[model samples]
Target: MNIAIGCDDAAVELKNTLAKHLESLGYEYTDYSQPAEDESNLYADVAARVAYSVAEHKHERGIIICGTGIGVSIMANKVPGIRAALCHDVFSAIRARKSNGAQIITMGARVIGSELAKTILENWLQADQIDPSSLPKVQRINEIEDSILSKSE
Candidate 1:
């Protein structure tokens, strides 16, 4: 699978770890942000670029990383058709893809270790929500989406 990976300075090391994981999993990826050296990294910029890339790529998945993960996730989710999920565990990662049909997974450098993150990514990349059991999961996620829209209106 072709993937896009982006991260800020705080997440550079974590991103590299994930890159290796992606390679091991027999996937190809393109990095879109963050210099090798520490810099004033902006989560919004990375999120915007990654979201745009995912939207353009259609079937490709994206992995975005930041310090707390929340900011980048929020930013990416702001884009129409982009379901960016900030997942810290395997279950949530699977849900992000299987339940919500998320095309992007966000992670926190300080929140999860490399090994655990790799496991979560593996589950995410392989998960499919087309099973009968996933209907309830999709329903629950749609309920949350409905609540968000209702509150916004």
Candidate 2:
């Protein structure tokens, strides 16, 4: 599946590591990461780009990173029809896709080591299908998002 990947300056190294891992796994991915020297690109902006790409179906999934992961996850989830999960472990990564049907996963560079990040990414990538029981929960999430968005409009 095609993937969208991005990161802020604080997580450039981790992003690079993940990019290489994606390559090794034979998955195609587009990089939206800002250059380390360019501090002008905000994490929220990066997260939005990846989230929109996935929401629009231009990519099957996305991976976004920041120093703490929280910022990007929050920003990505703000977009309509996007579920971005901040995952630091394999179980969370798997559940993010299988349970929540998350199209995007966010990671923290400072919080986890590179090897662990790769392992988490691998599990998330392999979690292609959502669990049957999670269909209702996932639908409810979509319903809630639609309701909130419609009310705002």
Candidate 3:
């Protein structure tokens, strides 16, 4: 699967590690992340780019990172069709994909170690989307998003 990844300065190192792991797994990925010294690269900017790419189906999935992961997740979820989930553990990562059908997973570089992050990423990638038991709920989520978006427009 083609994946997209992005991060702020605080998570640049972790992003690099994840990129290398992706390569080892033979998965193609686009790195939307900027260098640590690039002052113009904000967490919200990176998250928005990656989230939009996935939302538009230009990429199959996205991984966004920041100091606390919360800011990026909040920003990414603002996109109309984007389902960005902040996940720090294996189970949450799996559920993010399987139950919520999230196209983007957000992580905190300062919150989790590199090894743990890799495991979580792998779990997310390996997860199956929209388990039968959760299909109605996932559809309901999309309906809710459409309802809210329609009001704004």
Could you give the C-alpha RMSD of every candidate to the true structure, in order shown?
Answer: 4.3, 2.3, 2.3
**What TM-score do all the candidates reach, one by one?**
0.81, 0.95, 0.94
**After superposition, candidate 2 runs with Cα above 4 Å error:** 35-40
lDDT of 2 by residue, 1-153 (tens): 999999998999999999999999999999977644654579998998889889999999999999999999999999899999999999999999999999999999999999999999999999999899999999999998899999998
Per-residue lDDT over 116-135 for candidate 1, one digit per residue giving the tens place of the 0 to 100 score: 99999999999856457677
What ranking of all candidate models by lDDT puts the best one first?
A: 2, 3, 1
Q: What is the C-alpha local distance difference test score of each model?
A: 0.86, 0.94, 0.93
- CA error at residue 50 for candidate 3, angstroms: 0.4
Which residue pairs in candidate 3 have backbone atoms (N, alpha carbon, C) closer than 3 angstroms, thus clashing? none
Candidate 2 at residue 31, lDDT?
92
For each of the candidates, give the backbone clash count. 0, 0, 0
User: By TM-score, is 1 or 3 better?
Assistant: 3
Candidate 1: give the clashing pairs: none
